[model samples]
Target: MDDSIKPNEDIGACIPRLRRYARALLGVRGEADDLVQDTLERAWRKLHLWRRDTELRPWLFSIMHNIFIDQRRRAPEETVSLDEHALEFPVAPAQERMMEMVDLESALRMLPAEQREVILLVGLEQLAYKDVAVALGIPVGTVMSRLSRGRERLRELMEGRQRVVALKVVK
Candidate 1:
């Protein structure tokens, strides 16, 4: 019975980033969308609980991480299909960049969940290490450790993949 009459307007600015994180976390557009919606809904309801002086982004992400784990526990593990949309590209001019992104996504998927969450929050979302810890409910040291290990594994994964060079011939 204590929702905020006026929530921070800036909260909306984080939606795009939240959507990106959710998509990366869940790997399915529909499921990711649902997760984002659930996070927002929970944040809205718990607006009163948020301290005005603290950052909102991490709080929202924390809610999302918690929801993801809870849902994961209640349901049996299912093989997450490689999101087809991540593979789609406009044309060849940017195909190289698109392919690189696909490789990155593939590598990310291979990481342990904790490490992946840390890497995504820290590297992709650009959240500070402390902020990432807050979101994942881990210590900053743990966040650093995970990030370090995740980056190393990703580098190893990417290095193992045969690099493709798309050459454009100009006559």
Candidate 2:
């Protein structure tokens, strides 16, 4: 098999996951698709820069992460507000579980961008800590710290200790 073809195949396998992560990051199907498309384009263009010894999955993720950051910097207004749209989920067998899922989704959205990124990359995408570090261009220790804090904040939000308030009440 040609060595060049292997990377393309590997990247193809990661597309679904990349799209999932993008959707979670951007919170819109169209925006996520655009991010995925840009990521793939950049990855293909920079294929020669990839090291054979390094894992391809993390590299692709790194590309997507950088692209997301760049897009955010370029167009801050493009961010979608989670409160503007209702989160739709498939019918669940139990109402309690569905409510919990809804709460979790809301909590996830409330997290800070850094914490959210770490949580999504490590928890949702199932990337290793070191791989997440590389993808985010941060230290592994920072990744661990962010993940810990993010999980704690998520727990607090879900437990209703830190309620998501739209407006403050005043006397």
Candidate 3:
């Protein structure tokens, strides 16, 4: 068995878990799959450096997470137009609610990458503190701190949204 092929196979086996992690990170299923594919591409490119005995899943996840962060950093902030004709325009009441979920997911995307990453790892991915620390290349204490800060930021963002709604009601 070629040594390089073994690592590629191991990474291939971890794709499902990586996709799940990416889904939690990006919220959009398609975007998550794209992130997973990008991670696999990066992993395959760096196969020679991968240690045989080290865990592959976390390394793959870390790659995915970093790629997400880099992409977010590089993306331009464009204002979304609210043209009615442009919107898909869901009619069903339940569908409207689903659209709101998508809006919430978009808001989540706006969060700081470190906070978002921490929330996805601990809250969504259900990884242990130690594992998350190892994957993030940070101390377990740092993981806890990031999680706390991330939750607080999320709460503040939600509260601000509520205030806007309340103001509109008062008007």
Candidate 4:
């Protein structure tokens, strides 16, 4: 097998996992797909920075995580009115959600982005804690704490326990 082909194959195999994570994290098909495209482009351009000794999957995810963080920090770019360009927008999926999954998705949406990333990485991707740390560029302890907090919050949301905050009154 040619060495070039092997590397391409490896990267190709990871696309599905990246798409799944992106979709879960972003909750929109178009945005998720765009993120995946950006990730692959970045990975290909920075392939030299990747160490041969380390696993490629985690490194690819790290690149993706960094890109996502950078995008979050920047102000939104020029907006296109979807209503005016309905032909440009893709049709939404026709699948109907079960009640439980809808609730779960809504609950996931409510989570802080940090907690949501950690939970989806660990729970949905089934990545090891160490790999998650590497992917997110955080320590293992941080990943564990985020995952723990996220899971607890998810359970609370699923159980319909709304968190109440007591507002201070100054008059």
Candidate maximizing TM-score = 2
Cα RMSD of all models vs. native, in order, equals 5.2, 3.9, 4.9, 7.0
- Tens digit per residue, CA lDDT, model 1, 10-57: 667878889999988767788888999999999989988887777889
Top candidate (lDDT): 2
Q: Each model's TM-score?
A: 0.83, 0.84, 0.68, 0.79
- Candidate 1's error at 18, in angstroms? 0.7
Q: Write the per-residue lDDT of candidate 2 for residues 8-88, one digit (tens) a residue.
A: 888899999998988787666777789999999999999999987888888988998898888778887645566436544
lDDT of 3 by residue, 53-124 (tens): 666766777777678777867884633334312333346469768756555556566787677888888887
- For model 1, what is the C-alpha lDDT against the true structure? 0.82
> Runs in model 3 with CA error above 4 Å?
1-10, 27-32, 69-100
lDDT of 4 by residue, 1-171 (tens): 336546567889999999999878877778788999999999989887887777888898899999888998894552333432222324436434444566687688788889999999899998899999999999999999999999999998877633222222322
The Cα error of candidate 4 at residue 95, in Å, is 12
Residue pairs in clash, model 1: none
Candidate order by TM-score, highest to lowest? Answer: 2, 1, 4, 3
Instruction: Give model 1 RMSD, 1 decimal.
Output: 5.2
Whole-model Cα lDDT of every candidate shown, in order: 0.82, 0.84, 0.73, 0.81
Ranking by lDDT: 2, 1, 4, 3
